[model samples]
Target: MTVKTFKQGVFLPHYKKYSEDQPITTIDLPNEVVIPLHQHIGAPCQALVRAGDRVKTGQKIGESAAFVSAAIHASVDGTVTAVEPRPYFTGTNVESVVIEVDPEQKEPVWPEQDLSSLDKDAIKAAIKEAGIVGMGGAAFPTHVKLSASKPIDAVIINACECEPFLTCDHRLLIEATAALVEGARLIRKVVDAPRVYFGVETNKADGIAALKQAIKDDETMEVVMLDVKYPQGSEKQLIKAVMDREVPPGKLPLDVGAIVQNVSTAIAIYEACRYKKPLYERVLTLSGDAAARPGNIRVRVGTPIGHIIEQCGGFKGASGEEARLNKLVGKIIMGGPMTGWAQSRLDIPIVKGTSGILIFSPAMVAKTEHRACVRCGRCVEHCPMFLYPSHIGMYAENGRYDSAVEWGAMDCFECGICVYVCPSNRPIVKFVRETKRHVAAARAAKAK
Candidate 1:
């Protein structure tokens, strides 16, 4: 199983040194939790429980009629305080279920089952029932991803941990190697893929070594090292790097005889299959100058960000003054700097899709005023998808979404490299997403 190289991916500074070596620890439960109903990509789930209702951990609180959507479960046993529009990381107030925690922690009782004798269909059913989704920022339902109309030829496990200052996946690979490997094998069975490969970045030597050791006897599973680069862990980029196959525009990995799953997703699959437990907790990296204890923490879903920061020993300096003293504490981000959202408030809870909580002091975080695109072509040169971002950005800026789509705007992966390297500091990716939404709406109207 020789590793293959892909084209045109930049090696950005991996500030992973902050917590790469730190093992993941669990955060203490907070006084209350804010569980957003629309955490996944599909239609927002309707709330099932009302205020004053007592809900147990893993109880379904929100659900959707759409097959593409996933159910939302209560992360802890508590009394629902409110079910109304609340501030989320998306910069919008969406409907969320607020719960007041009971001082005595309690576990939700799940139905007993024997997964060892179950077939692939049973396994898929269990995963769907567990409300499992990709924890790697995408938040797409894991069951939907594993379900493909066409046959999958190969399965690629993403362990690259490419995002800087985020070592949750790296720690999972090292500490939960057995579960990760077993999960990959289960995915191979579910998708009926003959071959499975785990792709880890070269920077994570320990993770690669651990995974290699875990999968040594399984010839179908191989641990391959990837070049350390921003967005290298992305589905399209990883597929290109590991299999040399390009996922065409408006097409999926299934079109290329491949299926990709994150390491965290694999572990979740294993849990769903083995213990019949729903996804309620995930590894989250809490790092920055503001964090007195910067490291990876296994956080229970729906736990408030404020509690997480408190558990890590609250911010160093007093209120407004803290930002100045902590070089990396200017603003708080919910995921990796490249793909994460800049959060407005720390009151928002950690959702299933949260991979990291990055706090940047004004100095560590770069802030530049927007300037006109010089057409220097650095964005095009660095785009992993080979789409011309400058043209798309220009079209989007001018409100010509149709022209942007014609120029392959939908193909833009939104990796934020264009935003990162732009000398003019233009919000190229943001404009591209807006244009994409416009195109989607127009197409939907036309279809009707």
Candidate 2:
């Protein structure tokens, strides 16, 4: 079925050709991995192991008491080298467990299990025990997402792959169709949703076709092709497109009687249910002009970006020579260029949220200066949430925290569309984020 299109969305340059056609390959274990204790949205997990302690794959190393938080597992069989603070993607240094791989260690194996006889509760238990989270950037615990307290009319499987140069979801939809479907069934049973819908952007025709074939025998499952646009895969946006339901501000999909899960998260659910394997590895797209062999590789969570690039035939041109000869000016980014974070160091290990590792050569990295807002209304026009970014920016600049919140700054999805279309490059998203932080702090203080 063809899904309905939304009113506002932008079509940015998609540099996906770099690795779209290439199949996913697996990268060998790295010599060392830095496992941050805090990789999810809630409170950071406390360390369960100390330095110099031996660990095996799937062993839980970090756990938290917060109900919203998820657990962290050891990605490789190795010795804990350190249990100290380190640079994490959250823009702050946090305590992490660093493991040095035992090169002679054999590949980890999963314990045999019978899943065909298990029920929905067993599946949820397996997912929670395995520490699985959303792999499509949100990093929310999968078990929590699948377990909804309210009634769910339908379940939406997000396969849009809207961001540029990231084909991890697309490849998974193509290769792991059966697993995704089974995971969707499990989610349906858990949420008690009678119907399931798979939403994919039209750009991924192959994926849509594969999913359709996989669900052909299932009468309750339907595949809907969405208009190709940025942020199409976002929960609220996709819900609107596929189900024509508007999730009110500050409300979750459950409130509107829907639940969304990513394709990779579904695959992880299947593995957890059928094989009892924790989410220690994931498919990551290694691409850009700096890479010699651009493609997707199934990399262990702790595998370093430097090692992944080397396995992908190393960097290309002067970047390659400089990387091989001496450290250079090229920038490395995690996830899509639009919403992804630029890394100052390449030694950071791949976390569960990582979908792609983009290597931009010095020449390709554009360092644009921030300018004032031009009031062109492009940001407003392109915002998926239809909020006034100009007003939010002005309020943020004037330090009017209350006014910014009143102007619906919290509704901003931070999809970077405002930052992308601003002619003056005013970094509107950054200001909105700051305003959100201030507002959140104020609310917290008020609660006290």
Candidate 3:
């Protein structure tokens, strides 16, 4: 039982006691759902159904002919009210399919298929057709990983769930252990990989035990226990921790002869291949200091955050006098606190990459004005990628985008460790994001 980990990652509080042990509950369908045209990293999908068109559950409503893009499906049987711009979690408006949920809805039945006879192409086709993506929040299309040009020897299933307060992956491991392992194997077959590794953190002892027992008889599968560290589940860091491989900058895990997939992503792959089911719904954690009820829930893809929050009992102190004035909740984040977006409004709907909805009380949130960098050098010491975040932030702060890139600003994964450890409370991740946006815009202009 050797413990493995990469270097230079911060050790933060787990904060998972609230919902780590809770079983995933299926949430009731909302009155309306908003499915964004682009939920993944690649090209956006075009709407296949217009306003007033009726769509059934699991129906493909949006798709792109691009090889890197994943299709978008309807999560419920309903009529499309609009195919237009709507608010997203990222604080930007995106073209989305708005559907009014049918009152008398029937569950879509997916007849299970015999998975034994499916070949590599068939399995990949199933994954693409199901519109599965990296469910750990990246939302990178899974089929693109399977179509790797480089030879892959090891497939690392990231079960770390290292983000504080998000326990959806931990609950999945403990509850759906067999399905996760089978899904990992299916991914391996698609890539022609020889072995599979489940990289799990030590904090989730129950999940580790469940996975170990499930893979006991399989020689090709093994569970690697990782140290409890922030960003341990990140692709490059996970590869380094599990197989001692380093993915070079500007490259992918496949470059180092490995493929990394999140625990929930693997489970989605299994569901798609075995049951011919699409990824219309997913499990996510709803927890934080301001949440009235903290638990893991299986919700449809297009459900609005406002509806989900109300269904879960609303924010804490909801019935109190302060709640009436909306003074109880200070912040509502769409994912893990460290790396998630700070949502301004609750109307934003959950997409495929959503992993959690965190609500924080005003007392829990630190309202401080960011000051100048004090040059303490804590961000560099704690950054998992070992980049000079202070220098990058300083350069980007002064609109020096070239200098920021020279300092490896593009390599930073926006893990938020810099912001967490900075004494000045500088928003280094935000600065890095601004630098990236400027850089991308410049590149696009140059191309023109």
Alpha-carbon lDDT, every model: 0.85, 0.85, 0.92
Better of 1 and 3 by lDDT: 3
Model 3, global lDDT: 0.92
- Count clashing residue pairs per candidate: 6, 0, 0
Q: Give the number of the best model, judged by lDDT.
A: 3
Task: Give per-residue CA lDDT, model 2, range 87-190, as digits (tens).
Answer: 87646787889999988776777766776777878988889888889899989988788777899999999988889889888988888899899989988888
How well does candidate 2 score on lDDT at residue 127?
A: 91
Question: By TM-score, who's the top model here?
Answer: 3
lDDT of 2: 0.85
* Model 3 residue-pair collision total: 0
> For model 1, which pairs clash?
328-360, 328-361, 329-360, 329-361, 330-360, 330-361
TM-score of each: 0.95, 0.95, 0.98
For candidate 2, give the lDDT of residue 179.
89
Error of 3 at 331 (Å): 0.8
Error of 1 at 13 (Å): 1.0
Off by over 4 Å in 2: 1-3, 319-330, 362-365, 440-448
